[model samples]
Target chain A: MKIKKNIAISQSGFAFDPNSGDSFSLNPIATEIVNLLKDDKDEQFITSHILEKYEIDEFTFQRNFDDFVQMLKHYQFVE
Target chain B: MLPTYNIAITGLNNTDNPGPGVPVIRGLREAKSFKVNIIGLAYENLEPGIYLDGICDKVYQIPYPSAGSTAFIDRIKYIHEKENLDFIIPNFDAELFTFITSQDILSDLGIKTFLPTLEQFEERQKVNLPEYGKKYNVQVPNSKALTSLSEINDLRKEFDYPLLVKGKFYDAYLAYNPEQVINHFNKISAKWGLPVIVQAFAKGTEVNVIALGDGNGNTIGAVPMRKQYITDKGKAWGGITLGDEKLLELTRNIIKQTKWRGGMELEMIKTNTGEYFLIEINPRIPAWVYLANGAGQNLPEAMVNLGLGKEVIPYTSYEIGKMFVRYSQDLIVDLSIFEKLSMNGEL
Candidate 1:
């Protein structure tokens, strides 16, 4: 999915599109994913990094991480 | 400045509402160009949404009447006296009825409301609905606005299986055959206390077009969309964003023809004949306004700004392939219903 060029990201997890004049506030997990993408983190790297940092069990984290990735794909927010 | 142009939105407390009106209000305030204050008014006690807890300027809870038109009218009058609001925007089905019921009273209080006149409101009934669709050469299912249930048996003889028993502003039940039609019709009629609209079911893809009109029927911005998922409550649960020049033009023409203002969501079905069949015109904000805002055109904000005499820059191009998913709400409902049916061995 192609991210619109005019997309703006705030450190506090607020996303805005200057082209549309629309804004979205991302939850903590969504914020993390988008931020990681902005920093050019690959899927494997994001997953492994999250695994080491969070206290969640591997199965739960992987399921949620995968679901979020699918959602990003669904909304055309990411490739 | 202008005391922030006090604005109040009714129906924020409705159960299972997936509206983005509150979010749009917050976004406008964040811009800080204009002094905009949002007062979320609710008839029922609801768990406070994200906006109610200080994101908006204030949150006012209004107690609605238990029953009848008198109770509804009294609640709006009460809200007006308590808030001294500049303008009021009704956000749900019930509240729309309330606003329309007491529009003149609200106007007398110097509270600006952007909806059609009482005559226009009455004219948008089932009998007149199909005519509007026909004028644009849009297909509409065979429907009759019946005052009595006896008319159903007569109409069913001509029209075949799979009919939709619809309320002018309430419930809609899909009745597969004559037996089901009688059952659904009686139930809905008893509940809504209005003439029921019996329509032939059109099996096709569902699409929606929401437009902002200038009250003269000139549309400022319109978004054409296709439903990706539908909740059990018949709300558009998810949608794939698409736009058509022709669809937008037709929508504008209809609104202009009707002299419609405020917000409207036009429901359509893309039929097998490659035609879009007009289903219903809901004269208020829809559940999918969030998708429209996400793609482009912050409709709620645009309408509020336009109401305030602010110049709203028009945008023609929007991202075409975007989609929106509400998650948890849609997902849970779909799963739970299917699970129950499966457990019953019905699926």
Candidate 2:
């Protein structure tokens, strides 16, 4: 999945969907994932990259990553 | 020098179905008696009021009341210790129960709240409105709370078609038949839980009165308004205060009988025949509370004074024809404000 081009992430982690006129905030981790997604990174690539830096194991991080992606989908922040 | 009062208020969600927090804060900010600090307690990270400028001194995220009173009060206790919050006015129907039950506990921590007693709150519920009307000698449509889908059967025998299917806290739909009744029954129940209340629909103009009682069988302030414009969600988009004696008298009589404490909004139907039927009683301040402030009754301020054990006199007069037209505008907020509130739960 990819973060939509219309979705803008600010320096302090605020996400604004210009089309929906809805704004949201992300934690540091979410900010990183969305940034990677915006750069056309796939979920597998994003997961591996995050796992290299954070102290979480692959399985737990993937589960959380999937859930957060689903939330992004639900809010139409990603395509 | 006048002592500045620090107050916390909930219902900061100023969306389509708005909350009373901003308006209540407006009343406090405009108070003649003292300087004020507005503390916003919000349930969502994006409750709009948290982002608005000149509204709140500090905004903190609190656990939703559905999280239960223990967790709810613990969050308040933490905020109280840090801010020395003197008073709180919880403005959501879904949250009133938690706040009311924790009134004594908060008072022990030196935080004051003026709210309806538990008995008063229960008696004015939608399911009990018929009996409340009978007790107060007012008019009310027949209503019954239904716990199951089977209970929808034979409702027409007691009432008629085109009745109101209502949830305990919010949402209402007009159902023309049993099938439609069941449809709304499932929908509202899923959101607000049961027992879903069914009331005989009354056709008329809806007039609302925002009232404050001194908890002493005295009507402190009452302002009546007629909705000249309503939104698709059934919220009044624009309304004007009315100089209706009958409406004010009904408000006075109800407050006298109930000896209601703190703020309440009386939703009533004034039929074409000039009869008034009490529909709903919101135990806390209404979203239209700023309209009351515009009309000359500073109720939230009075509530703070009363909670502080000070004397307040009843408001005898107000200027009518003041209009409130609600509009939405996007406030350009810094990303750090969102970052602070979403991450730390405070801003």
Candidate 3:
């Protein structure tokens, strides 16, 4: 549930994992989530932030967030 | 003023399983210290580098290593007399033995070459992987060489199912059973000669390191890469430079212990448990060597400097996260160019 400290995300939503040398292009939502995670924000804070900023309901945000986090885990971006 | 050296290189076949020649030339062309007149020493007339404009100033069809050193060196002598060559870089694996043995004769002719010594060359061969691993303190899979089919039945005792059947110089197949092993053995042996290697299968992700050793136990340059895309021939179609310190440390250790000279590619597999096993050590610059250049370490340039007996400071760093994706394009050429190379042996 914790993002690796060395992950570098650019303004263009390009994410680079310096440790594994893997690069990824994140969408706006994913980029925001990663930025929030970098700032030590908890999942509850991220959920509320997304719900308040976007038109999506709480349940949809939670589901998408879970899926996104799973992908981050699969790519070894998060520990 | 930068001195221009006449350098000859081989293995210009830029096919699916590409050779290091084209990329190496690209590095040399971009060299900061000197300019070059590239001589293309090709075994076949149609090798892509021979046809590529501006890559080779002149191209000559040379005899294969199978022709033995006398004929090989004689052709080189002929080329040297005409070109006044300063250095030669032979890129193919099958030709390394001839080059290593002829190092002294080439040196006597004032043609400098940075190559591993014959002992260094022989000890890191695929057939000697086990001993090489032990001597160099690296982890290598248990492997046995089979000269005949009679040895196949006994392989099961030492290795489990889905082991690797490998040729001496090239090609490898995963054999699930004895029948497949025999098939691969016959196929590989027919192509690459006797003593096909049977190695225990190590399941993991394949990673590679392109390294240059200074023959004095110093690593001139090293860059680790992971294959982002693999062709059916098991060649890296695309790869990226990595920031993995462990792989770099391992490369430095091997270069230090072996006092390995010249360009080498270390093919390794990183198991899920985070252990790295040395799979194969290719004794020349890899086809993807341009990646090293793009990542900030121009190893081919360093190699030329070393060949010329110039002092070269070891490259301290390369930009990680740099990726190289390969592509193919058709080149339009006239019939006369091919005719000239085929008929006159030089163009």
Candidate 4:
């Protein structure tokens, strides 16, 4: 799933969505997820990318991603 | 005219070290003007370890026979009279037993002891988060403390899988499904006890705030931060976080109600609900005491000073976005295991 809108991330990891007005600080991993979402990566591609990068196990990574997506939806930044 | 006061830290022998003893020793040594003594069951020879290093003026070991008996009070009394000690600080959970058991009798020994009553201790050790969260206006998960395995079966109708089974003051295991939750619950409870807190797993960033409180519940000092990395044992091996005044205020409210004097760690999770959920209360110094000191509030030192009736130094705000990496003898072991698990890239 894509972010479907313009997203700006500062060097310090502060993220701003022009459509949502929900300014927040993202940890490094969260920032990477935002970048992928902006790039329109599918769930499979995102999972593979996260698997290659973080030390988390697949089961945990999947759970975390699902949670992260839920968070994004809660923040009204994703559909 | 140095303010000569003798002090002691009990339970300096807990396995979690450079345990609380190391910091207590260091604080006493740094406060060189005060006459301090080290006392403990000597789990690691910490008392003399610090004394020989000149951290304290005297180091005394409580005899084994005296421990957990009436003779124990005699031991502390002997030291109190001989040294004119101002206060006795219980360092570990086990030490609290002695002080609480003989609190009234020890009060006559002319040395002040800092501890909550037995009931207070048990109440504080509870895994009930929802009750505390709502009572204090701190957001927490929709959760319940389960006392029996049967309770989970009853709770299954309301809560979903991937439930968080948590030890009140220690560790947590995330079970992805009800079956897994039950399995982990039975195995862990056999080793520990319940009611284990069963809650909807919060898939969000977890952050913690560590602070010192006066027995009346006012905050003495605070350090708020987010965990960077966690070990399988549920210890934060490395973390990067910033301090927040709002978080500190909420903590202050909790302590006031509890009259929780001493060191405390409050865990909060920022959830998809767009709110921060207060999770648990640990009434002890966290493993990251050094990090809090780095953040400009030396909590151990402040606690020591408070015990002596000294004016505490004001705390300054810590840098935002600052990070800390914790290195320990145990972390080395976790790294070896993490290395093997690294092949799969998930733990």
Candidate 5:
């Protein structure tokens, strides 16, 4: 999955949608996920990378990943 | 030599229902006697002043007052450690009580605030307007507070058709009948809580005055404005300064009687018979305060000087006929500013 190219995401986890004038604050890890998604990383790659960095189980990581990505879709941040 | 100060200001939302933060900042930034570095205490991420350049040197999001005083003070303390705030100016009515109550604690931390005494604050409340007018010997229309929906029916007996139904903090609707009164009562009460105020509609042109008090019964400055045009939201879209002797006398008398401290906006209606009826008394500076600065009396600068414990002289006159027309602009802010403010809580 990929985030919209026009979405401006900052290092501090602040994401602004220029088209909609909507802004959002993401957790640090969620910020990393947005960066990776901007680079066109797949879910498997994202889950694997985060699992190694954070002390989370594969099942838990998968569940949170699915939920967060679903949220990105819900907010129309992902394409 | 001018002393440098790091001051914190709140109520940065310069939306259609604008706050006084940006206008106050503009006035202070233009001060001739002192140099100021403004630290904006913002409640929301989207407050226009947070992103507006040349207004606030930095912005930090603070918790809503409903989140409790502890959280609010904690954030201020943290900002104080980082910014070393000399003083604070709170502009929203919703947060005044919390700030006023915390003045002692802030003083202990070396941050000063000039605000109204709790006694003065309670006297001018919308629910207490009639008593305030009576006590101060000013002319005000009959207004009563409604705590229940059933009271709307009772209001009709004293107030005729087309009465004003208002909330405790904001919003006022002119209701012509029982149906509109109930509608506004439900709408206002649901938003601003109970004790809806129904006022007898006074037929007149609306006029407002922005005045500052020196805490000891002296008016530091006062500027009266007549709204030339008003938007649908009832804000002055265009207004002109007036040289009215009676209005100025009334303002001075009220300030002298109350011994009011800090900034206040007096809303009044001028009847066709040349009588002025008091309406609302906003405790903080109004959004249109920049007009005062344009007219020659820099009230915010005076308030800052007072908060800094410096002696200031009262401004006796201002240039009349100066007009102010409000306009909107869009600012293109970089993502890095937003990032620093959101991620690090500083920008």
Candidate 6:
């Protein structure tokens, strides 16, 4: 899945979709993931980065990451 | 130097179900091209806007529309004599008929008003929605106007169980069965008089567009909003501007077809399948008009310019994603101000 290019996520985790005019607030981890996605980072890289910085195991990170990605899709933040 | 105009406005009742007066005034106060000295025309002594600081330079109590055109015009003339009013904006639906019909008299008195023509106003009434839809080639849910109790039995032939029982001027209730329809019919007719309208319930998300039309078939401004929080009265407590091109295009088309003058709010239902059904068209500015100003289209200011016979260029863009959340606050007022307005009809 690819995040839409026009979605602007501020450093404070305020996400705005210019096309739909919908706004969202993301938690820090979600914000980091979105920033990584914005920089064209692959899901594997994002997962490793999250796995490295946090206490969670790889399996739990993968499950949570999948759920987060699903949420982004539901909000039409990703294509 | 920006010109300063003396403008009078009505509908100052800023309650739960707000009149557009306060927000419209807020927009006019923020106008960049011109300055305004606001004269508030109120029907009651205690309208919140009358007490609000810096909203109106002077507040004059005017006769309600129930008092005929003669009394209405007489009061307006009295106020105009004092204020030398350049323009008047009547914001209530009940009062619009009086103002629209008396446009010539107001103009003769050097008081300009930008309002829809009587024909435009009458044709878009809730009772005439079906015909308005047909004439304008817009999608409208099936509806029938009933003048008696017996008509409720016949509703099943056309509409489903869940339908809307609506009053002529205001109020709408969703009735789930024949008994509920009869109940609402009596309640609404008792309040707003005959020919209650029963409309098929269009299942969808309710979206609204606040728009302004210049008399010459041009849309000066149009902004679509989706209600984020809805009050029990069906008014939006919070709404966010949307970038829905289809909705904006529909608004523009309606304005072009009707050559609608003045400010209007289009209430519509956008279904999941992407079809839009025109529901109600309010012929005056809505209470949430400040959202348009916040989104970069100062419709009220544009409307004031249009009222002065100025050539206003249509607004081409507005920042999307702007949101308006309504809040209430208490204002301390001296009893003498209220007493003066009550006794002398001016404050």
| Native contacts kept, each candidate | 0.00, 0.00, 0.78, 0.00, 0.00, 0.61
Can you write out model 6's per-residue Cα lDDT over B1-347, one digit (the tens) per residue? 99999999887888888889999999999999899999999998879999999899999999988889999999999999999999999999989999999999999999999999999999999989999999999999998999999988988999997999999888899999999999999999998899899999999878899999998789999999988888898888998888888999999999999999999999999885679999899999998999999999999899999999888989989878899999999989898888899999999
lDDT (10s digit) by residue, model 3, range B50-146: 8887899999999989988899989999999999999999999999999989999999999999999899988888889999999878999999889
**Model 1's lDDT to the true fold?**
0.66
For each candidate, the alpha-carbon lDDT, in order, equals 0.66, 0.88, 0.92, 0.64, 0.90, 0.91
Residues B1-347 of candidate 2 have per-residue lDDT tens digits of 88898899998899999999999999999988888988899999999999888999999999988898999988998898889998899999999888889888999999999999999999998888989999999899889899999988879789899999999998889999999999999999999998899999999878899999988889989999887788887898888788778889999999999999989999999876668888899898999989989989998888888889988988998867677899999989898889999999888
Sort by TM-score, best first: 3, 6, 2, 5, 1, 4
TM-scores, chain B, all models = 0.82, 0.98, 0.99, 0.76, 0.98, 0.98
Instruction: List pairs with backbone clashes in candidate 5.
Output: none
Q: Which pairs in model 1 have colliding backbones?
A: A1-A79, B217-B256
- The 10-residue segment with the lowest total lDDT in model 5 chain B: B148-157
Count the clashes in each prediction: 2, 0, 0, 7, 0, 0
lDDT of 4 by residue, A44-76 (tens): 998998888878789999998899998887676
Q: Which docking category, incorrect, acceptable, medium or high, applies to candidate 4?
A: incorrect
Candidate 1 lDDT tens digits, B115-139: 7566566555566777756665656
- On DockQ, the leading prediction is 3
Best by TM-score: 3
Q: Quick one: best lDDT, which candidate?
A: 3
TM-score of chain B of 6: 0.98
lDDT ranking, high to low? 3, 6, 5, 2, 1, 4
Better of 1 and 2 by lDDT: 2
Candidate 4 residue pairs in backbone clash:
A56-B346, A57-B346, A57-B347, B139-B277, B146-B195, B162-B176, B228-B239
- For model 4, state the Cα shift of residue B151 in Å: 3.2
TM-score of 3: 0.95
Off by more than 4 A, model 6: A4-6, A17-22, A32-62
Off by over 4 Å in 4: A1-79, B10-18, B32-35, B43-75, B78-85, B94-102, B116-122, B272-274, B313-316, B319-323, B329-347
Cα error, residue B88 of model 1, in Å, equals 0.7
